[model samples]
Target: MNEKRMLDDQHFEQMIEEESICTTDNKVYEAPLDALYDTAMHYCPGCGHGVVHRILAEVIEEMGIIKDIIGVAPVGCSVLAYNYLNIDMSEAAHGRASAAATGIKRVLPEKYVFSYQGDGDLAAIGTGETIHTCNRGENILILFINNGIYGMTGGQMAPTTLPGMKSTTSPFGRDVETMGAPLKITDLVAQLPGTAYVTRQSVHKPGNVRKTKKAIQKALEYQKNGDGGTCFVEVVSNCPSNWKMTPVQSNKWMEENMLPFYPLGDLKKPNGKEK
Candidate 1:
């Protein structure tokens, strides 16, 4: 009995010493959930949607604009964004996120407004609405997620799909001649006089992810300050399931194929600087 007590005392002392070494100030990272709900995300493994969403929520929280923000998510993989973000999020018809955001922002000019859309919704169906919104120089943020293919609605070829890329509709490959060349919508928008900031980024690498987060933050800040007509941020992401490759393989393929077509960097900036 005495021997057991001595061992227990030694163990207790060791635990106490360890706890003393690990102080609250020593903590490096903690998941941000002030603006996000504590629930499992519906995105596939290695999907960049979750990462973008996290950084967006973090930015909103850090800026102290949770209640002063309104988001529009149209029909796509991100249609259910309201289920995760604990903020005022509204649903829009297919490819009408920008229009809806315009209405909302016009009605409530004091609030921070943004639209979250996917490539299929933005580049194809919502192209007209998107172009007009930017042309009007609406004080809103347009978040475009480009995965090269149509996700959530059968891996079909999207407007942003690269040449020679295979999809459900284009089994042979995306032929630029027959299917029309891949749309450089970001570059196209940058040419418009109303766009204040236009940048293309990716989330497959840690460095790129950090840069994307920073870009998103700058976009919102620009909107708040009325620095430009419109803020457009395109996050070139990967679709592992739709691409029919593992998460690792899809990222590698994106790095090699997608990056070349839709290179990362600022296409336009509010200060007249561009790449």
Candidate 2:
């Protein structure tokens, strides 16, 4: 009886030690108090950009890289994303964020460089720049927000627009006969040998938000390692204002339609694990 009681006490002590270690790790990962946007954002209630912004902010704060980070903002609804993020940022001309980021990183290699681009910009106009940058192994993080439509340009059909998806330009739904299939940017970019990490995630739900944060952190950590390669994150975001649907409906569309077309999770990791 005494031996059994002693065994139970040992098990209890081991549980306590494990709990303490987990608590310490959680504290270490706690986000900074000043790591969020200062003002109320104008994004719609169900807009995925807000969730992405918050996750980026938290990752920046948790990693303590804000002081050394430089963000390049692309043109679109996220044009004003620079104003919201409390970090050093530069605005690039429409669809030229990767080029701008390339220049910045070349001049300031020590800084953590990143470019935030949209589907229309990255998969369409800036396709050449995006491909070359990744191919050349530019040490930059490319946060590609693929909402499947051109939000700023009145819901036009973008390169990432899925089949049967309707946009302002495709009022009758995207026709694979002429419009072509949706461009899976992450999958395409992952094929580039120079790319160190490539992942696709969404922010339509709470569980996804957590996963998105980890993905962002992985990209940032890859940059920190001076990987000398591209880290691409294709985020499946929502545009309620342009989609002609309520915020909730927009999120539902993302889950019901978007996920099947642009499935989430890591497409490639050079090291075979999160950085």
Q: What is the C-alpha lDDT profile of model 1 across 1-275, one tens digit per residue?
A: 89776787779889879767566788775557788999999999998899999989988998999999999997988889999888999999999999999999999998999999999899999999999999999999999999988989979999999998999999999999899999989999999988999999998998998899899999999999997879999999999999999999999999999998899999999965676
State each candidate's clash count. Answer: 0, 0
Scored by Cα lDDT, where does model 1 land?
A: 0.92
TM-score of every model versus the real structure: 0.91, 0.85
| Cα shift from native, residue 54, model 2 (Å) | 0.9
Which 10-residue window in model 2 sums to the lowest lDDT? 24-33
Candidate 1: residue pairs that collide: none
What's the CA RMSD of model 1 in angstroms?
A: 5.8
Off by over 4 Å in 2: 1-33, 272-275
Clash pairs for candidate 2: none
Could you give candidate 2's per-residue lDDT for residues 176-261 as a string of tens digits? 99989888877888888879999999988879889998989988888889753799988998889888899999889888998988
Give the lowest summed-lDDT range of ten residues in model 1: 22-31
